[model samples]
Target chain A: MTTMAERTRTTSGAPGGTRTLTLGKAVNEGLRAAMRRDDKVMLMGEDIGPLGGVFRVTDGLQAEFGEQRVVDTPLAESGIVGTAVGLAMRGYRPVCEIQFDGFVFPAFNQITTQLAKMHNRTRGAVELPVVIRIPYGGGIGAVEHHSESPEALFAHTAGLRVVSPSTPQDAYTMIQEAIACPDPVLFFEPKGRYWAKGEVDLDAEIGSSTLDAARVVRAGTDVTLVAYGPSVETALKTADALAQEGRSAEVIDLRAVSPMDTATVVTSVRRTGRCVVVHEAPVFFGAGAEIAARVTEECFYALEAPVLRVGGFHTPYPVAKHEHDYLPSVDRVLDAVDRAFAH
Target chain B: MTTTNGSNEAIPTLQLLDPEGRRVTTRGTKGYRDRAATLTAEDLRGMYRDMVLTRRFDDEATSLQRQGELALYAPSRGQEAAQVGSAYALRPRDFVFPSYREHGVLQVRGIDTVDRLRFFRGSDHGGWNPYEHNAQVYTVVIGAHALHAVGYAMGVQRDGTPLDAHDGTAVITYFGDGATSQGDVNEAMVYATVNQAPVVFFLQNNQWAISEPTTRQTRTPLYRRGEAFGMPSLRVDGNDVLAVYAATQEALERARRGEGPSFIEAFTYRMGAHTTSDDPTRYRTTDQEEVWRRRDPIDRLAALLRAEKELDDDYVAEVQQSADELGVRLRAGVRALDGGAPVSTFDDVYATPHGVVASERAWYEAYEAGDPPADQYAIAETAQGGAR
Candidate 1:
């Protein structure tokens, strides 16, 4: 399968003018584009209207779309998601925003039991194209219950498509794709990378195929580094550090976590014969573990060593002071890469 | 039993018919009585037919479970009026979100008998098309569908349908007394009232949620909980079919007029076990069950019809014959149901193709085809000797 980056390179002859946008603004623009494209698309969340969300990811949306479309629901997370299910049943595409990752437990039952299984439970008679956008991961030195990486919890559930965007371009296209898709998507916005800017072409057309495929952001042959969301940046930085040491590293950005694009990582690992998976969630039963297991099974003959993982320790996101040590850093990813090489 | 207001004034329960099946009106029930008086004998007989058929369905399902033909069955034997009466009041355009054990409503909605039992038969989670009857499949989780009903009402509000129009859509959701304590139910009431969504919360206070009594679920009347949310709320004799029908019709009409949601606490009793797997004998006294048995919903309705000369032995025999035919059909159809191929489990998981599901399905198919693994890692037969 061709990566999205490769598809973009091959398809774009004379693309629209590119503009630098923060990851948050890219998502905002993507939401706006989707709402404009379909009248059925509406956003529901607390403080998203007028307040533009805590991170300003949904800034100015309620103003552009009427209040009826961009609804500011009551201060109830389960209410937001549960009602969105109803709205979806009525032929509306609802995009809900959970304020923070830690606050998502209130809506966990609705998301998992209702939204995730509605279509399958109905035997495909009902299509709930609800996008639950959650600002996740620890960064910016936030308080307790504000910083968390709960992607694996959702990724483990069937009938849910979990995806995270590492760049503004992917965020811009993927959010729109997720809204258009008929399945319920848990769009985990990397809170740490909300302000990270990248050039996004406004006129670029993204196919649905690219929504679940991983991309080779930076290529090499010594070892493959697989990461997603906030940890993708860490993997790239680790590759740069490895380059200075004369050890090449291939960096892969796994956009979708649930229906993981394992084939791309497997291809890269088969060539490199070594692999390390990275994420900001705890190493115990994290998305990295799934990637590691898949890499080992598929690339067993090509493997020169066991696949390694770099992620959070098995503890609550520590106090703000110790978060840098708690989250996966470039150094930790490099250490995992070194371990893979040593093996 | 009477409820009290803040000033300690007694609030009478709404009742259009007494336990003896006599047409009697209380002060609070006069308006509802006038509404029920408008129904013709034909409509009354139709309701009687539905109630009798629903009870028969419940009995047949319980027998099926006893015979191991069904995995489980939740009987709707005593709450027939609470379910059938309210369902009779809905228009074709109105939607319904029913919790599990709403077999009476499903019957009124014309859900296939075999289709209704499929969930209990362990063949499928939901067995019927929701849109076909403007009713959703049974939601097993308590109080969750209340929010869905309110949300659907909100969607109706946005659809530009004239709220005052007779054809305008409304929504009704049914749950038990036990669900009133759930946070989702409270949250649903909050959303419903605040949005003024066109929905009705039909609570069947069947005296017991399994072994737990209504007292354990609430200190105040369940309708008072809806009043707390600022909706017009009332309590009714759930055994009285006319009372339930009148109350639900008024509420549905109010909803269509955009007056907002209303809550009705149908005071009834669960005369049978919660499910076939449950033993109600272990919890409640038989004396209490005997008291409710005298106030049976189907018996009261049948007596009321017989006294008014609207029902006779011929009509009763016809109804019995139809119910017997329905039971036979349910038994034959349910037993003949095929769960379909095992590989079909992977189908419809996602509307779009998914890589993980596809790969896993492929692996499963290969395994089913008896293909040997390239790298088989298995414990040797000798390892079984170490088992505890």
Candidate 2:
């Protein structure tokens, strides 16, 4: 029997079901779903209004909601989130797209100081319920200050929920849930994965990803392959390839980066006894490091072979083909799997 | 059309006083002495008090940073007047967004001074709720918070959120000269203008971006930079708390009246390093510092206070005592914060972790149940059960 989740992505534009949809499109669909259900939903970004966006993620949004709702903003990232603080004060749900990952740094103040911890900081007087969408990761091979996986930065902030989705389904569901929640959320969509295709059931409302939960993408008895965002697809491919080798690798998708769902991961690790974690960011202090450390601590006894990490080299995401090598690959996952088996 | 300081070079920018502390009024004989026409003396005196207290706090926080009580501190010594004046000018309902260094502005907004310290101390991200005092948290990043302010202002414009013109809410964001270089800063202006979001872009032009000078930041005047983005720009004397207060009030009122966005460049100087990690002497000279030193805002206000005898010696002593007490409180707060303290913070990953995080949590649980390595980071080297 074929379950609904077993279908391959045939119709695709972007994450929200298009072959050509950029990460920007997936985010647009997320915003649309959230806004359609709740009038309080609004998006603000630089060039996000009449101009669509520098990347055009917010194209035609203002027209749908009017200029007052979809704000174009004065090239002020800090102000965008800063005023989102105010809008949320008046009971409006603000979804701010930071345009680019590198650009998001400027608004880090608002995100870290204000948006990240508004609920707890205010003693629950203000429920930010704001979604800050940032196009992250390095695959476009753009210039300096373009491709970066600063998820660790956000994940390191308290009082803010951090989640990343690898598929259109997750994107659609999670974006809506983010708007519905009373806490602030940092929604990081891989700029490179925006064009990836996936099926979306418009009729079904995907509820919240457990505030902190991990999902097993593939069932396996040997090694648990863990990753999220763009890395999840890679891990999936790696798991499929591993299946051909008769090593049923369990794949875990880390939809939430912070307030990490260690419980689910530990259960998977305890079940598999072996694990290989992966991510696109550098290994030094990336999300992969935190996952590897915590998993080692939580799933310590369950492991037969040691836990290993497959991630980008400890260097700045280089240009062109170098970036391809820089990012973890199926071969890297297999190699980590080999190391785990040898142990 | 050719407005200048009656000079062939156009005076470069407007000025009510040079660094020499000499009164150099702009066009028309309204003069610096009569600058108070737009501001009340009592307001000016209150502004002075705010500046003094903010400076005291700023200095105390800086000490905490140097003493390892804080990870970093962006001291706004000279820019106090700019922040306090601009912030205090806003209506209670008006929203304020500030860069990391806006402690003075936070004080003006009734922010718990300890809250700012907690953030820098790394005790917790931010300790205050923006809505509690009608102010947003201090964004440590460059200028992105300005765009959020713009978006919120857009929300305000959409909700028909405000009925009365003067009573309507307005958005104000504070950032340093360095932040103007950020893409979000430029984009914020474009959006705010086209949408006509009732927002004010408060740029504190303190003439330095870390070691980078203001000259390297822009070829044109900072205020005029807003004009290119279709915003009306004003360059005001940042050191004069009265001027900052008056200019900010005017801009906020204009914003509330559907006047769109305005950029007010608070022409001030940064008396301290960008943060504790910075060394200003490497980029600027003592002589240059001396130039701004003569333009001491606090001294000028003190001069004005003395000239009018608005404050007696006893009152000044009481203010000093209050400042000292605040310093002790901050020191105590800083002393209480310890490093390597367990902390977990996620920026804003919007999604509530459902599967992936849950799996990791489960893995961590069982792993912890089994004894881990002697050293946490040495996971690979020290096997869980074997090492334990």
Candidate 3:
């Protein structure tokens, strides 16, 4: 098994004019740069101040920006997002953090109904440029609500842009870009890979890396493996393992979950002729489900086999001891790949 | 804290005028009475005219809905004073977040009656631009906009608008007793108080939320709920236009001065059913209706005007003529409103162009146009080459 540090080293292979940073640190630097660039950019969430957030993703931000800009709100998710709505109306870009994925439901009404529709309801007279950051997915075997992959819930909603970053570079750039976006953005940070290191170019044009564009991380001819967030790393590993065999596998990192960049996936699938979708979320009605359905529809003639999916079962995210069994492991992804080739 | 008199019984619903159209001045509301006295006869007359026009508009909308011109109508029949008075107290720069039944408030905030009709008429979600009149679109989901108002008020504070200078910038959020039960409203109050936001939570306790009474929503007086959240709150005679205006003006002043959020529970009643779809007789009795009918806000003001010799048969007839004209205009405008949905329903789903949305929109358009499956499946041209 490759350690996160070894995998990170392999992934972040960029040479000149780049810095090696863990995904968390890269995001911190990105937030600092965004706040420096725009005075209207502010942070609001629980434990984000002093404690530096439950995951410390916002470490040292309060000290740098002062208490006003990096506000530590009470334990109220709804209020945090709800107030962000008002602040946005008042011409401020508020970046709200939901400590965990499952906890976001408390503020779902505000996010879906208020923050999402304010633009169209006002006939574009008002723009809610708010960013809601949720740390999601499972790997370290956290308890129930903490490990849930609820991106599909957000993706189902209109008026919101849902994106997840796999590599540190994407995390560094995506957070800043999401903040700069004119519409509301639901940024899903892969907490399982928060410490994964990657090379990030600080001087690169910010928001130039199109978030909604799916990128082919690994190229091959035999099959296309589609994944996002935590599963992207797993899919990449599966692709590497498949390279040792006679089969050649390609990997696509779906950075944008909602408003999915399926065109890239379809193009890859057309050449590969076979594909497997992977994610830590429930396979039923998940982002992977949508990707599979989309691939079949768009690349129907191009596919040699039906698109297969590797994900968690429909049951609740299990306890720590059973997490690995529940989550989509590299073996399971490869099995799905082999099944695709069986046809 | 609760706005209680020395005896601490919660100052018996502050009122400047009785139901019988007589001035009943009390020590608790003396300050407001003084403020009301500053208004000339013309100003008072203007307020009366607005109330009458709003009622007329509400009646016309209700009729339109019944005639199938509108999809639905949320009536503000009895709570006109509560909405109009607070609305009139607002400065042009101040923003208002209203629950669905604030047709009168929309009128006071410069949104045309025709523009307000767009929502019910299904022509548009909200026809007027919020920036044009400093009023947000009507929020149908109860208590949701309360937090939005808090957030906006917090933004108002950060914009360095000089809160203490009375630069006419603040936020007012409207909701009913039922909405206070929602976590969003409570959370909004939490943020508003913590941020010291320049927001006034104008809760028109219209006694019933649809069919559920205020008692079902809260045990203590609605005003006391704010006290628990560390907000200074007062109960006002929502039927008394002068009292409602005075109370709202004071709250706005407090907010502008950076005194944090204030709660005003207007002790009003929903004279009509919750909406045109509801039948109040099934849930409420006629005796209750008769009791409230005697305290009609418009009639009380008219009585006061007649007693002061400021109103005559000629002036009454003129106001009725104006109301008739407004009704005619509303009827014509609503009937002429387009009932067809737009071809681009997917537009504005996101401010920026999204590939999936673009694809879906194309599919929908083709389907609506009765195109073949091959044509329907084709993806639309992706929106510009920009950051997604």
Error of 1 at A164 (Å): 0.1
TM-score of chain A of each: 0.95, 0.90, 0.94
Deviating ranges (above 4 Å) for candidate 2 = A1-31, A44-64, A70-92, A96-171, A181-206, A209-212, A216-343, B1-41, B51-81, B100-104, B112-127, B163-165, B182-184, B208-213, B270-388
DockQ versus reference, model 1: 0.45
Candidate 1 lDDT over residue span B93-173, tens digit each: 999999998999999999999999988988888998899999999998888999999889989988978877377788999
Cα lDDT of model 1 by residue, A295-325, tens digit: 8877889999899988889988899999988
Candidate 2, B208-294: lDDT as tens digits: 889988777876667888888788777777887656665677778778888788999887899989889999888889997897788
Ranking by lDDT: 1, 3, 2
True lDDT of residue B67, candidate 2:
78
Count clashing residue pairs per candidate.
0, 103, 3
Q: What is the lDDT of residue A65 in candidate 2?
A: 82
Q: What tens digits encode model 2's per-residue C-alpha lDDT throughout A290-334?
A: 777777877777789877888877776677667777888899889
Model 1 TM-score, all chains together? 0.95
iRMS per model, in Å, is 8.4, 8.1, 1.9
The lDDT values for all models are 0.87, 0.73, 0.85
Candidate ranking (DockQ, best to worst): 3, 1, 2
